[model samples]
Target: MQLHDFYLSGNCYKVRLFLGLIAQPAELVNVDLPRGAQKRPEFLALNPRGQVPVLVDDGQPLVDSQAILVYLARRYADTHWHPQDAFSQGQIAGWLSLTANEIHNGVARARVGLKFGRPVDLEDAQARGRQVLELVNAHLANRSWLVGEQPTIADVAVYPYLAMAEEGGLELAPYPHLNSWIARIRALPGYVDLPRF
Candidate 1:
């Protein structure tokens, strides 16, 4: 198995974190995102969307970090990471959608703007980031995991950007429950640290 990764990307970091938690090892192929390598024809063929965090397992290329998480969870991880029950599946899917939408647009975008010097509406992104911090903090006030009693892809999916929320200039100290949840994930066996640029 191989992963097309960008070292500074929260999206790629999530996949790497999940693989670590699951005790799976995949060759990491660093993509030169700053150099526009992702837009190259070869990379585009692997992912027409031209993004990193593409997983190639058994010669099949899986694009999109969220989709790749579902694939890896279903194919390699134990059932708990992605429960087989219909309700659990739906719940996990909803969190994945949140990761793709709310999390991406808010926290991830702010991080990209601030850390990578990208052009973005920094104020708006930070406002969105704070809102997500509040939402997740409230949700995690009495729960150890996002979906159920155990750790699932939902937790892994949401962990990366939120864990690095400070980098985006959004304070984590205000969200105590969220901080506790982050600690829980960090304490899990085989857990990995956030990516450093």
Candidate 2:
């Protein structure tokens, strides 16, 4: 397996973190996003989307960080990371949707704007981020994990952007439950830290 990665990308970090959690070995191929390497023809052959964190497993390419997380959980991890039952899968799906939509548009977008100088409404993004954070903090108030009593891909999918919220000018101080959840994830066996801004 080989992961086309960009170190500063929270999306890319998702794959790296999951691989560490499962103790899976994958060759790391750093994509020079700052130099437009991902858009080059050779790299586009792997993923036309021109995105980093494309995972090549046994010569098959997987695009999108969330998709890669799903693939890794299903192929390399135990059911604890991605349960098999329909209801549980549906529940996890909701969080994944939130990760892709709210989290991406909110916290992730804010980070991209502030850290990478991408044009975006920082105030709007931060507002949306706080809204999503409040929801997650409340949901986590009584549960150790998102989907069940154990960690899942849902947690992996949402953790990166939220954990890196400071780079987006969003603070975690108001959400103690969310902070605790992040700490719990950090303490998990085989966990890897994402680069802080």
Q: Please list the C-alpha lDDT of all candidates, in the order they appear.
A: 0.92, 0.93
- Can you write out model 1's per-residue Cα lDDT over 142-165, one digit (the tens) per residue? 889999899999999999999998
List candidate 2 segments past 4 Å from native. Answer: none
- List, in order, the clash count of every candidate structure: 0, 0
TM-score of each: 0.98, 0.98
Strongest candidate by lDDT: 2
| Cα lDDT over the full model 2 | 0.93
